[model samples]
Target: MYRILIVDDEPMIRKGLQKLVEQSELPIESLRTAENGVVALQRIGEERPDFLFTDIRMPKMDGLELCARVAEMDADIQVVVISGFGDFEYAQKCVSYGVKEYLLKPVNIKGFQNVLEKLIRTKTKVSSETFVAVTKLEQWASRMEHAVWMLQEAELKGLISEILEELQAYKLKLNRVIDILQEIHTLLHQRLNVRDVYLMQGELELTGAADEQEAWCRFTAAVHGHLEELRAKRKGKLKDPVEEAKQYIETHLAEEVSLEEVADFIGLNPSYFSQLFKQSTQETFVQYRTRRRMEKAKKLLEQPQWRITDISGEVGYADHPHFTKTFKKYEGCLPSEYRQQMGIRT
Candidate 1:
């Protein structure tokens, strides 16, 4: 199903054409009408209709001019020109702008039917290609998720090699590949406690490669490096309860976690765990949690997209004012002031 927009100067013609399209039994999902090319351009921006039925001449911005503008924008919109004239020069102009169909006014029903059928067939073929693209991306995402789990288990060498191989297998466009990797990066933070505060927020801009193959190389290298660091941490000789506690805190930073909860989780008495944590980490549980939250706030401040209030809630302070007060105390400045000093602009 596709959306269609009908553009014309006359209300009667626009309504009539819309009715004809509705009764044509074509695969059109919806129909829209605009009085002139100017309004149609606005409709295109808003609705992004798949097909446009436009008149050649109109009061403000003729169809040819609209087509020219659309071509400059490089959007994937199919256009059919509706004209009162059957002139060869006008048809040539329409062809130059990649108009799919040029229909004469007082449209012949048979010709109109032929055009609709052709459009439906073309769209169906494109839809098939799109389905394949989506399926391939889904497979890539699944592989990346498995890789993250392997990282959590510290399967360092084998998992790293497999991840690089999987990156080579990616069939999607570079931008789509980047989006999937970013999603996986977020999962890495939540699941594996791979918290590079700067990278977690939008501080690190992953540069684009010359092509998909180059992109795969760069992306896999970065992932391999991050995982290697985690693997090193996991390769410690002695089991460290304090480190485990820190990992737990990072994994559940947004949740309402408590000292007793963490202590019980690692099979320790709250009192003894409290004393040990303070001795080892040199910070009380409450103070450590506040430090983690404030550090998270600073990282989030780097991302211009997130609101300060939203970052506050994300770091686990329900009340914005309370988060602000705590952030100021911890960072020696307000969150906004900190962001400004760090040269982050919204």
Candidate 2:
């Protein structure tokens, strides 16, 4: 199966080629079209196609520029230059760009089939070679899944290291390394998805790697980046201690809540919990509790039927004078002054 892009300014020829490819028994998974090289480059950058059927002449950017750019972008794509001109100059430029196949316009039905079959043969050969290691890759991917679940960093690196060593020792194609990395990336995300955590989205299409070693470098970089993301997400997992403490404090607003009790309730040391609470809420726990009590008192004061002393007791302050003092300190006025201003007679 392959994804192919047809790049031509003429809609008729593009559609015709698309129809022919579809009508035939070619293993085309996707067939997309772009009017010119400019559009083609954008599409290819986003999602590289397996085979490219592009005309030499196009507006805005021609096939020459597309071929040159694609060479720099990704060397793995199979590019075929289709031209009506049969121009030697264009053919030379295409060859220089490392395009091996060139078809004249008014493509002979037989020649077109031959070119496709040839590209498919080359593609299938490399693909089958990559598949020979599919079983091992699946086993490795399963191990990677477990390592990520356990948040084992060294294990992940060891797995990738062993894979790279084996790939190099066997002199296998870079596709095998790419496949393993891809499988690991997928498995890691699948595990995260089960946790309802969409940690990151990743794509690892290689630019023109200078050699197999460079390709491996790019692939491993991507693989390790995903691993790093997974580790970060794991560290951020579980219910936050600070949030649970805040909830408990809010619910027990009427009680004389101590930091030690709150810390013990959340299973953390008082000193560390105090520091964490301040860092997260940007306020000391005492300050937060005092403010919350005063807020509750203000609402209680709005009800004219509740006595001022009773309101104080309801907000965790049993002493009326102390409650009034604290309320004035926080709100710039006593609760009685607040009631008076709101025209709630006491």
| Candidate 2 residue pairs in backbone clash | none
State the lDDT of candidate 2 residue by residue for 101-159, as single tens digits. 98887877787889998898888886776464556766776786677656676897798
Model 1, 167-254: lDDT tens per residue? 5464444444454555554544454444332232111134433445554544454455444334434565245668988999998888
Q: Which TM-score value belongs to model 1?
A: 0.44
Residue 55 of model 1 has an lDDT of 86
Global lDDT of model 2? 0.76
TM-scores for candidates 1 onward, in order: 0.44, 0.56
Measured with C-alpha atoms, the lDDT of residue 212 in candidate 2 is 67
How far off is model 2, as Cα RMSD?
A: 13.4
lDDT of each: 0.69, 0.76
Worst 10 residues of 2 by lDDT: 171-180
Score candidate 2 by TM-score against the native. 0.56
Provide the global lDDT of candidate 1 against the true structure: 0.69
